[model samples]
Target: MKKLGITLLVATLFVSCSLSKVEKSARKTVDGNWQLNSVTYDEKGVFNTHLLNDVTATCFENSQWFFRSNNSTGTYNILDSDCSTGVRNFRWAANEIGKDSGVFDFTLKFTDDKKKDIEKNTGYRMNLKYLDDNHMQITQTIQFEGKPFNINMNFTRTTL
Candidate 1:
């Protein structure tokens, strides 16, 4: 009876662990180029608006590098998505194009790009809202210079 109980316990632990991890999967299968749909403040005393649309950005782990741009040369990366955190881990070559004045002065993009390994491991809770089949609103809330800001990006996929 003791041996049987131990075997059953081991089997149960394995199944439970696997089951829990499955639910931890990121909310979306984020493995492609997505546009900067819309970024909103969603907070009081905050001013925000749509800056760009259908920005070209590619997310491919197997590619030499992922690329993101606004119809011109913009940002790219060979990114790994934690379908668990929706955080895209970039390998190399990421850029923020265009000039815009927001509540945060577009600083989040730069800060996220230069994060260290220890910091990158702790993923942020990404809030991305899907509109229709190919449209999405990506909102990244982060702290820059010891102040919190939310950048709302709106985008639609580009058609070839």
Candidate 2:
């Protein structure tokens, strides 16, 4: 009876530790779904931006990101930051109406939103900050019609 009880306790502890590690790894932005929390957009160490309050959530499955944001929802083929893949591809409906789909490729890029907005903009850059499993900050440099613009978008997980 004593030996059986001890064995059960040991197995329980092992499982608990393993779960904790997995949870930590999942919280990382590169691995799983992360929601934007807050951002402060700046250029040359100064702030000059215009953006509405927005939130975004991204999920990685089968090497693609099922991305959803304010006024946009689509599937994005994402490339990792390691550059193992050349670029990410995505197809989204045009204008959120008429149910038309278009394709775009984001090359030399990184982020959970890469493939979503790849075309037209030549130099789009972003960085993601993970606050927890449910919170993140996404900073974006949006070039409008080949002009420079800055934006900071925040999002929180719906589950959270």
Best by TM-score: 1
Candidate 2: where is the Cα deviation over 4 Å? 1-39, 42-123, 141-150
Q: What is the TM-score of each candidate against the true structure?
A: 0.35, 0.28
Task: Report the CA-based lDDT of candidate 2 relative to the real structure.
Answer: 0.38
Residue-level lDDT tens digits of model 1 in 39-101: 456566645232221122222222221223211122333333531213333322212222221
Error of 2 at 138 (Å): 1.0
How many clashes does the backbone of model 2 have? 3
lDDT of 2 by residue, 72-143 (tens): 333333343432433233332211111222111111222244444444544333543223445544455577
Query: Which one wins on lDDT?
Result: 2
